[model samples]
Target: MTDYSSISTKYRAYNITPDTLAGIVAVVKKFTEGPATTTIYLDDDHEVKDHNLDALLADSFVKAQKIQRIKIESRKTLGPDLVHSISINFESDMLRVVQVTITGDRDRAILARRELDTLLHGAEYWYSFSLAPRSSFLPFFLSFLIPIVLISALSVFLTWLFGGEVTEKSTTGWVLLPLVVFLAGYFGLKDYVFPRLTFDIGRSADRIKIAGYWRNILLTGIVIGIVVKIAIDRLLK
Candidate 1:
């Protein structure tokens, strides 16, 4: 016959001292690890009952032993487990330190911040860096306006030279012929010349490979002549 016996469990508390007090201090100062909530247990019957765990940990000059164990606990589901132990075997006086390593993207973020600062300091300095091209519509618009002004001035000069004679027979045929030539040229090339020239000048300089520059010029001149003649007839009436 055999006798059955119940098993008894024993609980004990132990002291932890880090190998390197300096290393430990360095780690705490850098905040590399998250804040740890520590609970310390002591033998109430021991003589050194006045010293508490917080006070012992807070001591600036305290040197930890090489083989120290720390108890940690987790508070959240994703958090690390609680009641975990950490062993420290480093030198006691080297200062405990924890350093975080930055990844490549983090370095890039820092560089971007620096560039933004530079841009903010002197924005006008980078204005020429715009993605837009030079010699925009304004130049072409000025070019068109210049020719019209010149033609108007010439018409006025000729009129003045003729002493403002209101004779229809002398000037009617001359004006009507120029006007007919202008209308025929203008209507004939409006679909081709204007768009081609505008596109050539507006687009890349290398893109104007199509020939007929002289033809286009002649067509545009005729159109302008017709319009001018019509205007002059209206004004003379």
Candidate 2:
């Protein structure tokens, strides 16, 4: 892994204000663990007293200072109205760094980063299926097709239940099978088998292995069931 501290914490925010900076500090402190610091680049000299950050700002930027044990550095941006870029430094093994950058939206970035930190440090992952390249058609195709595949297999089950031949017409009710399965899995099956489903957090100790394994197993069962059902449907025809 690249050294986070060495890699200058460079980010730019449009229309940044004293309150915005304070809120950002609050978010970093709330979501992250361990000792961390914030360096605020100000445009001019200023004074800070009490917890009121507004007093710390003069016109363009707030004075840089270390407040509490949290270690805060505040400075002025290049221009008050212009975009503001700042860097932060921290010691590793104590804090986890989570940064999110979004063009035209600082609030979304902060919200997303906070949520991401919670998810990563929140729980462990057992299993996962990566639907990557959001722009690609694969995720959508699979999302629709996987449900269909599972439903087709379930149609075979119904055939066995009624001692009737499995056919396209006979399986019309399978249209509702996807919803049924979702409710059943979410409420009943998922808890006993897979605890949670999460995005790929890379290979880490927090990765939930059992959940991914069970997901794969369930997928395999669906494939087998679909194949058997297809064969039975063809024979009946």
Candidate 3:
């Protein structure tokens, strides 16, 4: 069996600052040996070209509009024709997913990954690959004891204060779900699941096995379920 013949990395951003963004762009441009095509995707679905990304991120208003993604692509001249591209996907104002796709032989792939590791090591706000570990902790009381307990207690207090008759078991899912959702929202869900399928027909098929897609789905379900549950309760009453 042959290898994937490509290398990719997904970077999750905690909060990408201006300096970090500049570093990210530099790392992306470094993948190519010569001039490359740099494209920026905007929130309005309008994509355009700008070298230093000045047009996309020039001012407060423009930045507020948000650059959804940025891509840099070029071929390597010294070696066999290799497809190299860097995709910077912005999930939100402070969240990002940086995808690096480089094609080459085993040795070259190893070196490229090493360089990527270096970049990831130096990046201040970006998390290297995967979204499951953080969000999965939200439902667990041990993880968010302070806020969960405080909010749960507050919910009971409000029920009494508003004369809703606070019960002995009043602190329940109703109070916790929204707090979990709010905390989950602040953390952000930034990575996307890669297409997973097998084909013997091709020379090589990319097998992407990512942990935490289920966790993300569960988190999403909890959020949606809470919304639906609220609607149902209100309508029934």
lDDT of each: 0.31, 0.39, 0.46
Model 2 quality (TM-score): 0.30
Residues 38-78 of candidate 2 have per-residue lDDT tens digits of 43321233333333444434323232332111124322223
Compute the lDDT of residue 196 as modeled in candidate 2: 29
lDDT of 3 by residue, 33-152 (tens): 444555656556967665654443553444444445555555554445444533444333222245566654455555655665565455523223323223344633343465446555
Residue 63 accuracy (lDDT) in model 3: 43
- TM-score of every candidate: 0.19, 0.30, 0.45
Candidate with best TM-score? 3
Question: RMSD of candidate 1 to the true fold?
Answer: 33.6
Residue 121 of candidate 1: its Cα lDDT?
A: 31
The per-prediction tally of clashing pairs is: 21, 21, 0
Highest lDDT against the true fold, candidate? 3
Task: Kindly give the stretch of ten consecutive residues in candidate 3 with the minimal lDDT sum.
Answer: 196-205
lDDT of 2: 0.39
* Model 2 alpha-carbon drift over 4 Å, by segment: 1-76, 85-164, 171-183, 186-207, 223-237
The TM-score that candidate 1 achieves is: 0.19
